[model samples]
Target chain A: MIAIDFLGAIGRLFLGFLQAIGTLSVFTANAVSHCVRPPFYFRSIGQQMLVIGYFSLPVVGLTAVFTGMVLALQIYEGSSRFNAESAVATIVVIGITRELGPVLAGLMVAGRVGAAMAAEIGTMRVTEQIDALTTLATNPFKYLVAPRLIAGTLMLPVLVLVADIIGVFGGYIIGTSKLGFNPATYLRNTADFLEAIDVITGLVKAAAFGFIVALMGCYHGYSSKGGAQGVGAATTNAVVSASILILAADYLITELFFSK
Target chain B: MAVDTRIPKVSLRDVHVAFGPKKVLQGFDLDVMPGESVVVIGGSGTGKSVMLKCLLGLVTPDRGSVKIDGQEVVGISDREREPILQKFGMLFQYAALFDSLSVWENVAFGLTQAKGMTREEAKPIALKKLAQVGLGADVAELSPAELSGGMKKRVGLARAIAIEPEIILFDEPTTGLDPIMGDVINDLIVACVKDLGATAISITHDMASARKIADRVAMLYQGKAIWQGPAATIDKSGNAYVDQFIHGRAEGPIQVEVRA
Candidate 1:
């Protein structure tokens, strides 16, 4: 009887997983359908771009710069043991552009934009603003979801590119001025080590991460139940889910791009 | 007063809404006439909001038909439903004003976006609506977050009437206001509906606001309309559920769920 119960529990868990996947697919399909049809809201799209992209630049930049500086110091200290201190520039450029830039930007956006989206939409759901939108002859998906998805997908690539450049420059500044490395050789090594594909891959990853972050945020927000507690839960879930998905997708994309 | 049956403005026949196994509304039937204000009063969990949502197509009834002007809305595509929706405006329970936009912008949102009016064309109309709700032009530029609770409610009312919709929905329009402010809002609601000659449906637990705003009142309990009559006859409703609700009596036919 105990074994049978255990098997039942496992089966229930498997079914729950499949149900979650099915629900997510349904949500994605609905969003896509709404996006393609309609009385398109270009004004909303532009406004969201300003909110998600322009307003987010300062924080993303600061994080990238500090991360780059810290990374340079760590790489320099580790390479010094092998008498390979000069390799600091190469590692810093490659690491920032190929990995850290997109990953960190995605995570930062998950915290900032994802939480904001979830909270705003979740509150709207609880307060019945979404219903009000429907009563006004406006499709909530077209008015709310499309602009957010578009903004996140389009803006993250630009943000990641900016972060990559600033991060690499930050490493260059720290390596040459603070660590007493020859500036010309540092710049030359950094340039020689980084390829176009590294940057392109990072940007591609940024776009995917952006979609995941926004999709999770909007989905949780749109489906939020209860009242204040529900909005709070949706906000938390959106941030956590976006962060986890970003990290997981980062690894998967990396494997696809660089696996042996 | 005899029931005037000249083609009811809104009608719900055998409406049923279920969230999986839990039935929120069951065989709910109602008919509201043109230019009439109907207030649906009920206990907290009795599906008053669900009924309103179903009427607006925000929640699909699993079984039944909702008709506006004798046009069947059940299973209608969103595209087919737009014109029906365009007749409606809603004042949400929390005043659900867009925090991102200023007061006037919120009022102007429907006119500019849904109606394709220019900002120039929308501003004066927005200001006029605000004035009707006793808000001034000076308050127009302030963000929704900056407003007091009563002010937000007034702003929400202004936004609802901005488009001059033929049907207006008020979901708990007086929930969070003081009695004096609640009366003020009720008065504004009456004035706005009268001015537009609009069919109005209000869901509220506030009996005072209901008496002031509704020409007729319906009591919803256990997923159905239990008692409905002229607002003046509520004191003599005779039904124990209606009696228990209006008097706020704890001990009666209704059971309040208290989880230990």
Candidate 2:
């Protein structure tokens, strides 16, 4: 009897997971369709872009710069042991543009923006504001989810682009100031080693990560039950899921693009 | 032959809904006439909100039919439901005002977004509605966060009525307010619905609110309307559940689940 109960629990868990995936998939399809449909809420979309993109600049910038500096220091220390200290500049540029910059920005924004969406929408859900939207003839997807999704997807790439520049510059600052390298050659090496595909791939990953962050946040919040505790849980779930999905998506995109 | 012209504005038949094994509604049925104010009363966890949500298409029933204005709405696509949805306005419990937007913006949201009215055009109407709800122009620029509970409820009411909907829904409209404030909101709801000649359905455990705003009272229990009658006769309702609820008695035919 105990064995049967254990098996049943396992079966229930599997079914629950599948159900979550199915619901999220449908939500994504609905949100995407709303994003493309006419009668767009331009002002709402613009406001969300400002919140998700413009406000995120400072955090994303700080993260990218610090990461770039640290990457430069680490590569210099490792390569110096093999008499290949010159590789530091090349490594720093590649690391920032191709990986660190986008991933760090994605994760930072996920923590900041994803949690906000979840909390805001979750509060709305518990407060019955979302249902109010429905009765007001406003589609929650169009008024709420679509704006955030578009803002997140469109804004993250721009953020990552700026982060890429700042990150490389961070590496340059550290190389010249701390690590005693020829400034002109370090800059040239940085430019020479960087490829367009590397930047493009990172940006594509950033966009996907942005979408994931918004999607997870909106899904959790919209479906949130009860009051304060439920909103809190949704906020935490949004950040965790967005971070995990970002890392996973980053790896997949990398494998698709760079792996032979 | 004379026509039977009095069709219900909203109708639900044998509706069933469940979350997992917890069935919230089983064969629930209700009919609401146009220009009628029907208040549904029940204890907590009695599926009152679920029934309201089902009527609004926010939650779909596992089985049964929902008809709005004599048109079948159950299982209809979102695009098809837009016109139907446009006929509604709702007042949420706790106000549910959007914290992100200023007071006027929240009130004007549906008008500008769903009706495609420019901000300039919608501003006067929003201001007018706010005044009607006993709020002044000074409060229009304030965020919802800055408002008192009563003020927030007023703003929420203004927003609800601004769209001039043919139907209005009120969800626990008196839940978080003092008795005086609750009475004020109840009065405003009655006035607004009467002014619009809209069909209204409200769900609340507040007897005072129900007595004040309801033209008729429906008692929901075990996923169905166990008793329904005119509000004037509530003091002598005679139904056990209704009596227990109105008197706040602990012992009745309605079971309150408690774990030992």
lDDT of 1 at B46: 87
Question: What is the interface RMSD, in angstroms, for predicted model 1?
Answer: 1.4
Q: What fraction of native interface contacts is shared by candidate 1? A: 0.76
TM-score leader: 2
| Model 1 per-residue lDDT tens digits across residues A105-174 | 9999999999999999998888777876777677888899988998889999999999998998889889
State the TM-score for model 1: 0.90
lDDT (Cα, 0-100) at B165 in candidate 1: 89
TM-score of every model versus the real structure = 0.90, 0.94
Off by over 4 Å in 2: B1-5, B258-260
| Cα distance off (Å), candidate 1, residue A152 | 1.7
The lDDT leader among the candidates is 2
How do the residues B1-260 of candidate 1 rate in per-residue lDDT, one tens digit apiece?
Answer: 69676988999988899998899888888999999999999988889989988878888999998999999988898788888887888998888887778999899988987788999999999999999999899999999989999999999999889999888999999998999999999999999999999999999999999999999999888888889999999999888889999999999999999999
